[model samples]
Target chain A: MVAFDFISHGFIQKALIGGFFIAMLCSTLGVFLVLRNLSLIGDGLSHVTFGSVAMGLLFKLYPFYIAIPIVMVSAIGIMKLKEKTRLFSDTAIGIVSSLGIASGVFISSIAGGLNIDLFSYLFGNILAINWTEVLVSFFLSLFFIFLIIIFYQELLFITFDEESAQVSGINVKKINTMLYLMTALTVVLAMKAVGVLLVTALLILPPVTALQFSMGFKGTLFISCVIGVLSVTAGIILSFFMDFPTGATIVIINFLFFVLSLLFKKIF
Target chain B: MKETENVISMQNVYFSYNSAEVLSGVSFDLKKGAFLGIVGPNGSGKTTLIRLMLGFLKPQIGDIYLFGQPAFLFKDWHRIGYLPQKTSFSDNHFPAKVKEIVALGLLSKKRSPKRIFREDLRIIDKYLDLFGIIDLKEKFIGELSGGQRQRVLLAKAMVNEPELLILDEPTTALDPETRERFFDILKEINNKKAMTIIMITHDIGTIGRYASNMLYLDKRVIFFGTFESFCNSNDMTEYFGEFAQHLICHRHDTGDIYKKSYGRI
Candidate 1:
């Protein structure tokens, strides 16, 4: 039987709220990530964050704050390198993403013996969320959502055809760099609760499922969020019952939704 | 739609990439309401010239003006619309609906969110209706024939009600009927809407009859004037003859002149 005291059980409530916000941001941003043909970028950059977080832990710094700035700078740096090299975004992502995984493993090994709990960073323990983290996630999610709404048109144009976007007065290079940074930031935030390895799956799977059968951008966003909600709700329930990892379970649930969407698209 | 000012002008333009010169001392002036068709062989700088005029790359020498402003400025470029050589390079599974693809053109003008502006909607409707494919709007773009996708792209280019419309090799992938239909639409737009157009293509047949001004660019401004003068050029006897032969031979089922000339222009 569950305890009746809701206010005192802030951690439980906070985890749920954090899930809601994380679902909202990742799912919405996932649409753009998919549209730009950069779903892999989310996966790639999350590894970079993994490396950065490991760096923080090695230096005994607060991992989230330290990882945030590093992720932001590296996102911008990778974008700049892409522009100068004129490579496809995927190739650039490949290079940056590999750098992340390689660096994370390299630094952690050399710094000291690995802490077993540090392995939990691969997939988060959402059940351990505290009040401050929950509040921060909620507002950051809301702010990111608002910013996305404001620049929705610009982002769509850039995604559709970057040269056309530029010709129509959009500063596409700036917007492109900004989007990579946004993806990096969103992944960094989610890592606190969802963790690094699983955050990308959460980011991509929901929107990709929605896009398989949806029409308008708004429809895609709405459907992705709905799918995200279902995954989170089910993941939380499954975690409670099965004694499973919450973050990994959420990602798996969303992946199941993606598969279902693919099947439905085929059948329909 | 705006007054026919000097929409694009270039002077003594020189361009190159890694020491191989593409455009050498080429100068051309495109006024408002002119349909300038640039025709040349493969690797003849037709695409490069358009890129230069669009300010995709700066000329090594001279200057280009767009909407009376320097070409490099961001606001100066907003007055233009561009359609690439191919609409999309998809095999069989591109996920965009035709309507979704058309909406991308309108995306540039949206003032708030991803909402379609009323004017953009009107333009989309007008263009789809103008091209007589309003029914194809909800269909998947990948499911479309090449011609249908080209029409959708045309709608996208026109959604801005752009002052200058630039197309690179627009009709290459189309069947003959669709190709003619596409040109007819362009001709009508030239007559009625007075939209300035710059068409760059290797298909000399489309250029011979329709081009108001011809810019026969090789490595430089080979010829820049009316199509009549281009056809009458001492050198174009061979170029036009080959193209005219191809054109006539294509419509030869109706016992056109090509049958008598044995596909020799």
Candidate 2:
């Protein structure tokens, strides 16, 4: 049995609270992205966040202030590239993702090498989350989640059929841009908790696991959020006791849930 | 809202893709309550014309109007119901139910909150029953067969009971019996509700039996008039030859004409 003493630490509390909000946001957005065949967008935007973070560190500025705007712009750029050109969405994502990582490497070399600060961002250090980040994630997640609720029907319509939704008087372009912007914001917030490399795992695994069950869209969304929060909670506690990386632990737990869901689908 | 006599109006519409010139000098006016069938061969701009009318594509040198408003500026979309060629929900595991899919039809008329009240559910069920799929309301859309899926989508399109309905090759993947039933439903809606309808189809032979006006198009408007005129027109007879033109126009008249004219063919 593990002692409850670690629960009193402010850092652990911050990680738990912040991680919960981030997990909820990622999983909620993941459902739409996966259904729309835009799952790779999370991975793509996270790489852009990496380059922005490196630029911030090189300039001695707060990373998120730079990372947020840059990643958002890159997200829109990926969308516009796919629209203007005849390339498929995956190809566009691949192009943007390659540029992001290549630029990060170039910037890092120009700054001499990858330092401990950048390394922390590369692998994540959720325990170092401050009170400000906790509040920010909480409010941001709540705000977007509320927006999702208000536009829930419109989003579902567009995901099902874009042309029919357009005929229904939905501004398909505006809604699509809003979706990309929301994804960019989620990617930036999730980066601090899971790092650039593992952010996609958080955005993908929960919704996919929920999809294994034969349920309605709303049911799938609800189950995805439950899995997300559960994994984060269990991961933070297990990492505290087992001395494992919190981000990796959470991702692993998520994968385990996915595998179990597949097996459950097979058995029942 | 003031009523418009013409449901759609297009004047000298010209469209091209990469200078290929898919459609040129296309002009037509569809009055209210007219059932118009747009038939053409593949790559003949039937779909493009539909897209332009729906404002999905703009013409380089023509004006299009819907309900007397410019097509691009028309905002009363709730008055129009559309069924595309193929829905993206064709994936075998698309996680949406029949009821949920049908509910999407009523969403366009809603305000920001857009909540589906109990009355909306009743309307959805009524449509499902009309389509004979009320029992499948809770089933996933992907789990249904092609015919059932078409019915569900038709229900979705008709749930709003719009003033005008547009269908793009909606029966492309169904059996002949299912297609017949589908057209029967459309005929009923067109006759009973006096709804204006524009359907693009490859079933040129069968479309004449139901559509009041037939627009035979090949890039430009080859013919746009009532089926009676098309049957009696010497130009159509010359263009399609006696056998083929009679084959299309025969069904519009009586079986006696089909037997007397093209029975030996």
For each candidate, what is the lDDT? 0.75, 0.88
Interface RMSD of each: 3.5, 1.0
Cα lDDT of model 1 by residue, B1-265, tens digit = 2333787878898889879988889888888889898876788888887777767888889888877776765375446778987432343444566766777776555444557656666667778887777899878776788777888887888777777899988877778777777888888887788889999877665555566777888887777887556545666657558676345324324433323434433
RMSD of each: 4.1, 2.6
Segments of candidate 2 deviating more than 4 angstroms = B1-3, B250-265
Question: What is the DockQ score of candidate 2, to 2 decimals?
Answer: 0.72
Best by TM-score: 2
lDDT of 1 at A84: 82
Instruction: Give the native contact fraction of candidate 1.
Output: 0.37
Name the TM-score of candidate 1. 0.88
Please provide, for model 1 over A1-268, each residue's C-alpha lDDT reduced to its tens digit, 9 standing for 90 to 100.
3535532466667777877887888888888887677777777778888898788889888778778888888788778877788888789888988999888898889887457555777787777777777787788777877777888777766766677777776777777777877788888877766787788787889987887875566777888888987898778767876888888888889989989999999999
- Give the best candidate by lDDT: 2
Task: Provide the interface RMSD of candidate 1 in angstroms, 1 decimal place.
Answer: 3.5
